[model samples]
Target: MAYEFTKEDLKEIEKLKTKYPEVTPVTLPALWIAQNRFGHVNPEVQKLVAKTLDLPEAHVHGVATFYTQYYKEEKGKHVLDVCTCLSCQLCGGYDILNYLEDKLGIKKGETTDDGMFTLNEVECLGACGYAPMLQVTNDKYVNHLTEEKVDNLIESLKNGEQPEYEKIGMPRRNNIK
Candidate 1:
């Protein structure tokens, strides 16, 4: 089926466009809006975003593909992005990744059959000081991980629980002003 944005999405995009002088600059935010609503940026959604912003489809494709944050395919309910940077690697990041794979029965970049979780080995999550950390669905960070903690986290999530996690890095600057 051909994807199209909702009326509410269009309104949000219009508001976002006002922040920038040109429509081209709204590409990233528009793409983010699509991802936020759809959980991923598939080809149909990419085309929708491109048309909405009046940019070429190829440009949208390039921007989406260039960034790891943009998922071109469908993702699971909870996206687990494990940090594999140098600091994290030295602190048992690979071990944690392997453990998650074994526990979830899916390899990195693959979603579980139940669609509960997707694993991704991502670069620096900006919490190098707190090695062995991961981001959950771009919302929360779990740090100083271990097998026991992983088991507990999975069980909690399976029970439809939103477990609270500590933030590992400094706060991000979402606005210039």
Candidate 2:
């Protein structure tokens, strides 16, 4: 199927382009808008972005594929990105990853049969202090995770609820005061 960018999307992309001296930098945000509109940026959508900016399709594809956050294909409603980087690994990130696999009955990099969740083994989400954490749909970070907490998270999501947790804001600079 052909992908069409909404007029609003084009306008947004236009606005973003103006912020940069050249159109190359606009590729990232354009892909973001495409993903938000189409839920994913497959080849066709990448082409659309490239065409919209009058750039090469290969360039758009490269940018989109470079970021793990961008879904190249259609994904489930909820995506679970298990962080298994250095800090998370030391804090038993793999254990959490395995736990989710078993609980969801799907291995890492697989989506649930019910089409609700897609589990991913990601490197880092920049929350080393919140080790053993998994990001919910690239939005919420469930941190300091344990088996019980994971269970609660699953239950809440199953019940059509977004599990809420305390967000650790960026550390305030001591020099500010």
Candidate 3:
């Protein structure tokens, strides 16, 4: 399908352009604006962003392709990013992924039939301490996952309620003094 940025999005992109010295710097924010408006920065959206920013389509395509967070294609309402990086892997990351797959009836990288959730097996979210964690819609991190917690999360999301997770401050850096 075709995609076009709204006037408000264009205004936001215009504001972002002023914050950067070169168009290169604005690519990220411009892509973000397009993604937020269109739900994914597909090829069409990338072309739109490039045309709007007066940059080459190849440059926009390169940036969009480099980041998995950009969502090259459309995704469900909720994208569950399960981390399978080192810490998470050793701590049953695949187990959590399986549980979610079974619970949602959709494997990793696939969305449910209802289009409510899309399961993704992502690399680390930089939350090693919180191994076996998954991010909800690229926003909230649900860490130290368990089957029951996953169940509750699904239910909460299904019911249109944001699950409340406890705040976890990062461990103190030893060299910081």
Best candidate, lDDT:
2
Q: Give the lDDT of residue 21 in candidate 1.
A: 79
RMSD of each: 5.5, 3.0, 2.4
Q: What tens digits encode model 3's per-residue C-alpha lDDT throughout 59-110?
A: 9999999988899988998899999999999999999999999989999999
Instruction: Give one digit per residue, the lDDT tens place, for model 2 in 1-177.
Output: 779998999999999999999999999999999999988899999999999999999999999999998999988888999999999999999999999999999998898889899999999899899898999987899999999999999999989999787667777788986
Native-to-model Cα distance after best TM-score fit, residue 164 in candidate 3, in Å: 2.8
Give all candidates' CA lDDT scores.
0.91, 0.92, 0.91
Candidates, ranked, TM-score? 3, 1, 2
Name every residue pair that clashes in candidate 2: none
Candidate 1 stretches greater than 4 Å from native: 167-177
- The per-residue C-alpha lDDT of model 2 at residue 160 equals 94
What tens digits encode model 1's per-residue C-alpha lDDT throughout 1-177?
667788999999999989987888899999999999888898889999999999999999999999888899999999999999999999999999999999999999999999999999999999888889898887788888899988988898889886695754676898968
Clashes of each: 0, 0, 0
Better by TM-score, candidate 3 or 1: 3
